[model samples]
Target: MAAPSSQIDQLADRIERLLVRYEELQRTNALLQQQVDSLTQERESLKSRLSAARARVDALLERLPTLKNAA
Candidate 1:
């Protein structure tokens, strides 16, 4: 039979380990969430710039026909 004191100590150690793991996971989750938010903002900014660039390209394309007719 196992000693009662050793059994209690083992249980306590397991609980402590679980708590530590939980805290580590919590921290990792928070860091990942922050990174995700930052990436989302960057993606939105890039999309906006892309849209503006496309508009400029379209305007230039529209003028090409007029330029060719005059040549």
Candidate 2:
């Protein structure tokens, strides 16, 4: 049978490794959140610009005379 002290040492080593991996994952998660926020802001800005452009196009279309009116 293995000594109790050896088993305790093995468990401690595994715990340390798990902690390191947890920290790395936390950092990676933070980076991904930042990217998601940046993309969301960009998407909102593009949507606003598109809405403005569509409004201008609609206004211009209103000014054009229809074929029925031309006849």
Candidate 3:
């Protein structure tokens, strides 16, 4: 049979390692969440700019004379 003291020490070491891993994962998750938020904001800004550009192009096309009208 294994000694009680040695078994207790082994269990304690495993718990400490697990705690360290858990903390590292939490930090990694927080960093990923921040990245997601930044990208989402950038995507929204780009979409708004694209819409404005399309509107400007449409206005310019309307001002141009059509071939049928010119003839």
* Candidate 3: C-alpha lDDT: 0.99
lDDT, candidate 1, 1-71, per-residue tens: 89999999999999999999999999999999999999999999999999999999999988776865888
Model 1: colliding residue pairs: none
Candidate 2: residue pairs that collide? none
For model 1, the superposed segments whose C-alpha errors exceed 4 Å read 66-71
Q: Estimate each model's TM-score.
A: 0.88, 0.91, 0.88
For model 3, residues 1-71, the per-residue Cα lDDT tens digits are 88999999999999999999999999999999999999999999999999999999999999999999999
- Candidates' C-alpha lDDT: 0.97, 0.99, 0.99
